[model samples]
Target: MDGGLMLAESLPRTSSFATDRQRGGAAFVERWTNARAGVIGFLTGRGYSSCSIAERIDDRPETVRRMWTLWDLSAYGHDGRAPQVVVPLSQRDRAHLAGAAATAGLTIEAYCEQILVNSIRR
Candidate 1:
């Protein structure tokens, strides 16, 4: 999931919808889908309540809640291959990260994942 988000973020964001329409919709759909998933994953992983997340994303709270319920159930199907890992940070560091994430229009978790992946690649 982290890798997917990293790859998606690496892509350019300049072309307009007109260009996308001319080229066909696959790229547009794929990019939009990845971005949507990244936002949802980031919000949920960062311990935001569904209502809060929905408000932030301009979505309905019930829709966000339902998505979360489905996500939780799907995690159990991972067969222990994707155990959750906690990374502790100082309050100041967390505040900094939250600000950065908000500026980038991403959840803190997604922002952190992107940072980690970039660091690793370097």
Candidate 2:
């Protein structure tokens, strides 16, 4: 098991979605620190779905999904400067790419972007 999963398992589980912001306007959302984002990315690499992550962190599944996307974008240097591009691959190739990305603790998009960046830098 990843160390992050172990630590996440020990987090206090909450049934309510209420927070300080709900009670008062003191806070709105939990700050996404580098460590927190990395943990989410790690869990994602382990094939945990967004719902699974949301349950673990006691947040909405949608929030987890958004955060995961944001983390991927930031980590891969995708500054939204370039428009999104789609690369269609065969089923076999897609599966292979996904497997490789999972092994490297990254999403398929992030893994592909990383490869592109590295190739450009070479």
Candidate 3:
């Protein structure tokens, strides 16, 4: 055999890691776009940027932006600036929710949104 080549050996295949890196680069672009949209939307609504929200929530700017995408609210004006809270409902509220859901032939969440929309319309 000469220094030129070896016919017995085939070239090595591409590494999955390399392919994944390429894919990750593209995915990063997509994720960044989503984050940008979310941050811009939040900024428009609350007069703040990703960093402001992150500081408010005790998270990093990028992390907060990622959360926006994860929550499926990366689009503009997706969610309000209200802080989310869990309230233990009284039996009365439960009954009211059930009745409203049944009346609308919708799930409890849908009924709640409907109620919220109506309340906000005022």
**Model 1 per-residue lDDT tens digits across residues 98-117:** 99999999999789889888
Best by lDDT: 2
Model 2, TM vs. native: 0.37
Give the alpha carbon lDDT tens digit for every residue of 52-119 in model 3. 65554344778765666776763554454542223347789888888989988998767777777799
lDDT of 1 at 72: 80
Encode model 2's per-residue lDDT on 1-122: one tens digit a residue: 34324444565554443332232355554445454555556556555667766786566778877775755755764433353445657899999999999999999989999998899999
lDDT: worst 10-residue window of model 1: 14-23
User: Which residue pairs show collisions in model 1?
Assistant: none
In model 3, which regions exceed 4 Å deviation? 1-53, 56-58, 67-88
**Positional deviation of residue 85's Cα in model 3 after best superposition, in angstroms:** 6.8
lDDT of 3: 0.53
Per-candidate clashes come to: 0, 0, 0
TM-score (C-alpha) between model 1 and the true structure: 0.36
Q: Estimate each model's TM-score.
A: 0.36, 0.37, 0.37
- lDDT score for residue 51 of model 3: 62
Taking all chains together, the TM-score of candidate 3 against the true structure is: 0.37
